[model samples]
Target: MVVESSPTMVTRSAGSCEWTLVAEDAPVLFPDENLAPKLLLERFSHDELKSGSHRVVFKLQTGNGCYYFKHYKISDWKSRLQNWVRSSRARIEWDHTWKLIELGFDTCLPVAIGEKRKGPVVRDSYLITREIPDSVQLDQFVEKVLPALPERTRRQLRFELARQLGIVTAQLHLKGVQHRDYHAGNVLVSWDETSLKLKLWLIDLHQVSFGSKLKTKQCLRNLALLNSYFSNRGNASDRRRFFRSYWQTFQTKKNGRPRGFQEYKSTLLTIEEFCDQKMWKEFARADQKWERGNRRLVILEGESEQNACRGVSELDRDFLKAVSQNPQNTFGLPLLNKSVSVTKRVTLKGEQGILSGYLTVCDKHSKPKFSARTAWDIGHAFIRRRLSTPRPLLFVEAKEQQWLVTEAIPNSMPLTDYAQSSQAHHLNFQSRRLLTRQLAAQLAWRDRCGFQDNHPTLFNILIQPDSDTFFFLGLGYLEQLNTPVSEKKIIRTLAAWTSGSLPLSGITRTDRLRFLKRYLLEKEGDWKRYWNRIDSKVHSVHSN
Candidate 1:
């Protein structure tokens, strides 16, 4: 049976069991009744477009033209039932492409669609669309093509492309069409030789949905997904121009230029805030779902965290035993507090440098209490909370021994090292003040987050050479207070800063008070009491 809806698109029945869609009266790609998608895939010369558990796509050449064939596979009863009720992905994409084209938007031309069903469930489905000729992905165009062009040409191309993108996005929103996966990879770019203009065609329409006039939050989400790419490739001014162009096109019939600075600023702020909030929520969810086993500690067996590390060892029982047994791999001297703390440095593949593993032991049997695994988890927590700290590489438990590996910070000295050295007196005045101010800000932030570091000391902070950035070393015992961090924790941290055993003995009460003002902000009496306590503690230690 055959049906020709258009000269380009043809729908026909293939053999005894298969339905097919193809271009220009072309023969069926799959003719065998016994053949499955996988077996059929191997017979053709094709480049894979995408391969996942649910669907697989390939760009293959046909007698008619180059076409993309996407095979949707149902692996389980749950997906089968859902797809059966909601319509197969193939039908959705095929219908959506036709609708979008009818709505005056460019998209890949659907050539054919097929579905092989079993009773009430769709077991397998396929969608075929003709490939756009002379097209490149927008990201690829930006990365490989734009940088090679002349400066003037590059600027003109970027501006024009951004303007066109703005127009299309505005059109999509105003028409109430929302692309769920609205990122750069789904957008295809082509240059028109005759018009001397650029054309864009959107793809991956299976998830596309239509609604009434899009709300501001919905529009912002779509914009943020697009902005994620531009934020990396384009400058602030470029992004601003893109948004401004979008607003102008959106308001073409409704209003003139922005009424005032405040309105314009508010729109920009909304976009920024929504984007940030959406991105953060995604990051947090990703972090939570990153592993399967324990939330705090998961054994790394070919997990992403292992691959993410620069010098990650192939974590296994034998590898852990080897690292635990070797002393040359150990950092610092051997076993003073054998049951308390131990560290080792492991070299990496290539010239990627080394990683250090520090373990906190608990008892005489060298059984760990807090453990290296805990430190690894806490390090990631701090990072997700936007605090600067050493990057944890891997954690492994072997023979009841635990190890945590972290990237080594180079050309850095502990804050205590700076305070104890002769260089302490000759330290740059601006550098010292800057470091102090940054420390105040970090402490204030910690307090706000209800964090109290029990071992707050100069030794716990590592200042990178000639940079405002610093890494917190004493994270193993970091605690979350049930209540907000009290004034006592603040005072205790400040007292550690003024501990007179080090070079800061030359610092006066006025200097301490001024430093406190940066964080405490106008708590003169509290600052005085904190300073007196610090002085009294130093005096008492000296008297003892």
Candidate 2:
């Protein structure tokens, strides 16, 4: 763990690219010719891990083993100048990783570092690290592998996993290093077949910070960052155990308690609040991206980015206008429970042969700007949020009339139609349970996006006839609340779902509660109270 000498740079004849060997151990293993960035670039493309704006990561297979190579590219003058005088991210990570290993923490071992410069500008750079063999991401292991184990084995594994992660996190804090992007995905857990214990290692160390012991706020932010990803994945009890184990280790390191009981409890609350606030911000940003006045979309529309007549291509604005002019021209079927809306399939001949789309002309309430344009924006919003809606192609405003053209979804049936079929009744109990659980989960997710549909029901959804996957069909009413959604909103949506789908779909009250339990990840005792309170509220509203 000692520095042999200063980092030596090798000038390669290929353009301005150069190789820097920081650790002396690298040259002894990887020959100078093979370590060239140009040679690495010429290697097969199949081992690529990821390509991003800042860097590209790939794995190189050799007789020895596999090595990870991350090449950083400076995209702008600002970044180029910044890295010219200073070490690149690859170098920083290379140095920090060695520091972590020297401190007796498990992390990826650095192999080599490379950079491509244009005169004084650092153009492209990369760092190489040896892969951690027989390891899987902590998140993937928890989601995919953990559930298949026996109950006793699973319980033991879960506890030990949490304890080890807690210990590592505490150790990092004690060493005054803050892993800014500390999430489950960044942590690797390797199992030893003989020892039956998991070894935890942290990866992606470029953002790792080193300083004096972290402040209270800094500690909370670090812990909150780690907890946020697991918020929905882990059950309340599992999360509580992890938090308790982490805090216990944290306090032990301080030789006593870090703060008074009340203060410490308040800190935990602060961490929860911080995590929730971050989640809300992400939701808000996503919600805003679909709004009518979104700057990017507006610019896109003005620029006529695609080959289309009348500032549109993929969708025919002229056809949409014709549909709006005379709705009766094409015979159409009416959507159930909705008299104002009508859908007719239309085909347009394009350069790519025949393209099928749906034209929906609906009557709108007499409100300012409440035209087809609004529905057009809302449809895009639904698609952006990954809701199951026909993708909107274009929105045409013809006088007071509204017309929306959308790409048609094939091989799908209305949720109501699917629910009443013999297929639904004949489905196995597990399939039925999975369908119900997914529906509840979607409702929960939509609620998180601040969508408060006044008449939420299975009738407003589309289901894949074979797979049973469902999509939200009624995007016209999905107005963005643009605020942090409350639990009450979710409860009300769940209530509507039960009232609308249960009677017709032959779903019993107990099965509905079971679905809710899975969505909420609630324990038996907690679920009972939650169901009672929500059920009472639903009944009171109906009776009134």
* Strongest candidate by TM-score: 2
Off by over 4 Å in 2: 1-34, 117-121, 134-164, 189-200, 255-264, 285-298, 301-442, 445-449, 461-473, 482-492, 503-508, 517-544
Candidate 1: list runs displaced more than 4 Å. Answer: 1-8, 15-17, 20-25, 28-43, 63-65, 191-197, 253-265, 291-544
> Which candidate has the highest lDDT of all?
2
Per-residue lDDT of model 2, residues 1-544, tens digit only: 2332234544333456565554444554345556557576565343878987887888877655777888887877877777867888887887888788877788777767666666765677778777788888998787656654555566678777877877787677767888888988899888754455888988998788787666666776787777666655545666667667767766775543333222556756776787778766654576565553443332233333321112134434454344434434522534323236556787653433566777666644432323456456666655554455676665545444455566777888887777788887787766677678666666655655566675455577888856556777656655667653566666676777666765665566766877888767642237777688778877886799
Local distance difference test values of all predictions, in order: 0.64, 0.65
lDDT of 1 by residue, 1-544 (tens): 1223344645455432255555543454654443355544675678997888898889887555677888888878888888757888888888888878877788887766777777766677887777788899998877556554555566677877887898888888777888988888899998743354787889988768887657776788888888765543455557777778777776864543223312767888878787766765664564565444343333434543232111233334344344444422432345344455455455432223333433333333454334455556667766655567887766544444455566677667776666556755665555456456566656665665456767667677777754456787766557755455777776677666667424654343544565676666423346566667767776665577
Model 2 per-residue lDDT at 440: 65
Q: What shift in Å separates residue 330 of candidate 2 from its native position after superposition?
A: 17
Summing lDDT over every window of 10 consecutive residues in candidate 2, give the lowest-scoring window: 303-312
